[model samples]
Target: MKLKTALLASVLTSAAFAAQAQEVNVMSWGGSYAKSQVEAYHKPFTAEFGIKVNSIDADNPATPIKAQVEAGNVSVDVADVEFSDAVRLCDEGLLEPIDQSMLPAAPDGTPAADDFIEGALQDCAVANIVWSTVVSYNSKNVSGTPTTIADFFDTAKFPGKRGLRKSAKATLEMALMGDGVPAGEVYDMLDTDEGVDRAFAVLDRIKGDIVWWEAGAQPPQLLADGEVVMSTAYNGRIFNAAVAENQPLVVMWDGQILDFDLFVIPKGAPNLENAKKFIAFSTGTKPLADQASWISYGPARKSSGALVGLYSDGKTQMAPHMPTAAANLENALVNNFEFWVDKDAELNERFNAWLAN
Candidate 1:
């Protein structure tokens, strides 16, 4: 009887240890953005559920997710990806469909679907923040202030290397805007070969003076080091550099491209259930708002806006810094995800060819 009792106790102890060892791997764009998620989501989540979270970083999390899913050796459980990548991966059957029922309601009992901003809740992903890619300049590097998208291409006036993302997505949109295409007509214009040529024509004018950056963190570094007078960068990165680090970086919202970063689960994720739980918890009202305090990106939930009051420093008000603020939205272009979902490959190929020549 004593031996049997001891055996049962040992089995239960092993089970508890096994449960404690369970963890979910999350991938995100590195730098301050990933740090924000760690403070706002990962720490609180591990404390609550006793589940460990392995935080990872990449230039673009979506790339590794697709590779891992296709290779059938899935390691990452959750990833932060752009809206277009989420839709494209889902359509490709590379991601698991996320059921909306798993999400928590708002504090006032509003359903998740109703609480999230339009297009925030996707069939296979849940958005966490609304961020933008904007032109930023070092105050000490230039003589006059650049106020418009056209100014970004006017190297004769600015007269320094310009920083641009190496990708075709936002680069093309901004190029068109620089050439005088209205924000509303950018996608419609890009649908044709003539518009494509026009955007490249603008890029050609400054191609000799352009420095291409591939990572989110590189743009601010490029600007601060004076490698480029002005660079297209993620707004939150510029905000952190200018506000937190006391750098002279400035964000120009005139031709900003707004988009969402969402949480998605790759198909065959090793910790599927934990990934779902993490998504539900991290995208909840408070967590979403808490992330905003650490960075200038706006939360995706309508209810979260009221909770976002100050920067983590406690002195800086966050509203005016957000990409969605009224003043910033005057000439802003919300990214057309559907257009990118269809044209990504074709346009990127063209962009790469242009870079080569």
Candidate 2:
């Protein structure tokens, strides 16, 4: 019942249950869902080690982490950062390199190092969570469930209340796809103003019907309340609602954004050694697979990618929450972390202005 500080070193100390009690600090996103999933990652981890887990969380974790590293008093040994935020911090030299040798072997003994999906893992950060914004439609109310982004925004066909995520990048990418852009061309098209405007123009046409959900889980909530017959929602939450509640909600993986969040070691973290141990352990098969069951977020570990205990049926797994559906995985537009990392302020400002207007 007592909430002990869950910090970075929590993973290694949690493992082995050895006599040496070391304290490590971890920084991560917090909410009941996020907190519970993160804490679950620590459970099997702590069982093997003798260290104590101290987890520190925040609403928006980037700026505080930057300050901590800049001040040269890095108490955060391991940090769970958003995909975009990780890129920004890495550019500022606040993140440390991940040493692959420390990681445990992949199940079945295939090497995990560099075996991850192409471009999914990076130098300073490794994939921790794989998520997607998917098309979800109420099966009970709507005659035919929508399966594509274009179908989600199609008013005449699937007419009802609709919702779209409020974020700039994911929305832009989805809009482009809705406008008929191919998955491969999404990044190239987004590199130009015309392409960007074209995507927004599609949204402008449906802005009135859209609920504009800012939080990831909002789509699923809206669907349940009947506020939206259909909307773009997080894959996990949508899948959970659909399978657990057997709601008529369904998803189309035709065009989705499979965004991955990562764990980065702050440059001056209080305990770099323990942090690495935690990361390696977290990305290991067991914890990664465990979080998948509790939360819909897919594990980053390539070895763990083969559909764990989340759900068995293909129909259920393809809901807006699960990223493992072959069709959806192929259609996903991975976020361009390099571009956004350097252009965060300018792009985000422009994005806000665009949204306001």
Instruction: Give the clash total for candidate 1.
Output: 0
Error of 2 at 279 (Å): 0.8
lDDT of 1 by residue, 1-357 (tens): 999999999999999878855899999998999999999999999999988999999999999999999999999999999999999999999999999999999999999999999999999999999999999999999769999989999998879999999999999999999999999999999999999999999999999999999999999999889999999999999999999999999899999999999999999998899999999999999999999999999999999999999899989999999999999999999999999999999999999999998
Lowest summed lDDT across 10 adjacent residues in model 1 is found at: 16-25
Candidate 2 residues 261-290, lDDT tens each? 788899977667778888888887767766
Per-model lDDT? 0.96, 0.73
TM-score of 1: 0.96
lDDT for 276 in candidate 2 is 82
Off by over 4 Å in 2: 1-21, 29-36, 54-60, 67-75, 141-144, 245-247, 306-322, 342-344
